[model samples]
Target: MDWLLNADTNGEKFLVMLAAVGLFVVVMGAVLVAVDRPRWVPQWLVVLGFIGPAVLMLVFGLVYPGLRTAYESFFDRNGENFIGFDNYVRVFTQDEFQIVLRNTAIWVLLVPVAATFIGLVYAVLVDRTRFEAAAKALIFLPMAISMVGASIIWKFIYEYKPDQPGVNQIGLANQVLVWLGLEPYQFVITAPWNTFFLIVVMIWIQAGFAMTVLSAAIKAIPDDIIEAARLDGVGGVRMFRYVTIPVIRPALVVVVTTIAITTLKVFDIVRTMTGGQFSTSVVANEFYTQAFTRFNFGLGASMAVLLFVLVIPIVVYNIRQMRLSEDIR
Candidate 1:
């Protein structure tokens, strides 16, 4: 037990992991044996044997932590004194936090719409084309990269340097600006607009995901419906606007809601690009800044709770839309 508790070396850690896995296997084996005895064991007990571990895990891992965070939100920075609603009030009333909220709203609103739109358009244009696979692979490449890695890649793209006789703009964007004979602009350090530039990174990453999902939905549109639309002279833009969009509405909803949720909880890009400085912070980054960096547990927990609250509706709507789509099908 002491060795398992104090696993300092790599080998000891491996052994501890093996031990845990072994225990899990033993417990599951027992449960399975119990469940196999359907004649002897009650149906409810057999059912419990299958699902009980999962229910217990959800309670301990998700439910408890969520409840604890909500409880901590009412406490002070040190989490010792009670300060009901102050942190939430500060989040709304404070100018800095207002900016955070605004940025978050912008992200949730823009990323999904822009990414989904771009992806839908791209998916439509490239579908069944000669270069379809290549085009998709190109667009979807960024989705393969980790968020931090994507942010880092875009950080270089947005990098700015002074326009001097010998100084060269290394960033792709600044280089384009210089090519157009325009001064290199600060992408990450500037306020207000910097948030949009950060949002662009998310859009770029998510567009691939949106494209993949929407493309499949587009392909799944019944051939008979498409042929019928074409017979009605519904071609080109009208065909897309009327026939395609209506058919893939559910996928669009799922894509938009999923992206919105991702955008709502975006932290890596902002943190990596600007470290949430220069009025570019969103709720997730702000939560980290408050709770972990500033040691303001109460405010941090409030931000987390606020994010959770925002996400719940989107999740519910996504699920409802999925069910409705299934029903329609």
Candidate 2:
């Protein structure tokens, strides 16, 4: 019994050990029951008994914590005081908060459209090429990298150095400017523009994902329609305009809306690269900074709630798009 609350073990470690011991006990008890051949219980009951633990685990682990966070959102920094609309009001009325909202809007708007457009073009061009797989793999490689890792890589790409003669430009963008005989620009440190630059990283990563989805959609188009279009002298751009675009509309909608949702929740790229500085903060990153960094739980909750509210329209649109897809099928 003393081992259950041992002095050498922290609460986390104790809980972990207890879980392991409980698992062992359950396994052994199950084996014993099997050996004894108890006929009173049905086989389905035994199977469900095994599954019950996993269901309970999810309810405790995921459902509980999310509910707890929602409850805390109405509370103050220490989660003691109740300040309902004040935090939410500050989110809209405050200049800095407005900037965060504006940046978030830019990210949600630009990243999805730009990424989807690029992906659609790339998918159409590469669909029947001899090097299609290689081209797609090259494009889709970014999606393989996590957002945090991609942000670090792009941070170096947008890196800046002082205008001093001795130090070389660290950022690839600045290096390119130097090569083109233009002055090196401070990318991350620049206001407003820096937010767009961060968005470029997300676009770069998500373009691959959009490409994969749209490319599959393109391939699923009937050969008969393409042939009919070509026979009608719609060979190149006109063929794509008349044939491919309409055929893959459902997939395009899914890609665009999925990327929009992802862009709305973007935090790692902003957090890792800019640390929410230089007015480059978006709703997701600002929520973390306000709630965790500044310990202003109420303000952070309001920001999160705002984000949730914004995403609802997109989600509804996505659902409608999915229903249309099912009808088409």
Best by lDDT: 1
> Which number leads on TM-score?
1
In candidate 1, what residue range of length 10 has the lowest lDDT sum? Answer: 30-39
* Model 2 spans > 4 angstroms off: 1-47
Model 2, residue pairs in steric clash: none
> How would you encode candidate 1's per-residue C-alpha lDDT over 43-144 as one tens digit per residue?
999889989999999999999999999999999999999999999999999999999999999999999999999999999999999999999999999988
In model 1, the clashing pairs are: none
Per residue, candidate 2 scores C-alpha lDDT tens digits across 127-175 of 8899999999999999889899999899889888877789899788999
Per candidate, the number of residue pairs that clash is 0, 0
lDDT of each: 0.95, 0.87
What TM-score number comes out for model 1?
A: 0.92
Question: TM-score, each model?
Answer: 0.92, 0.85
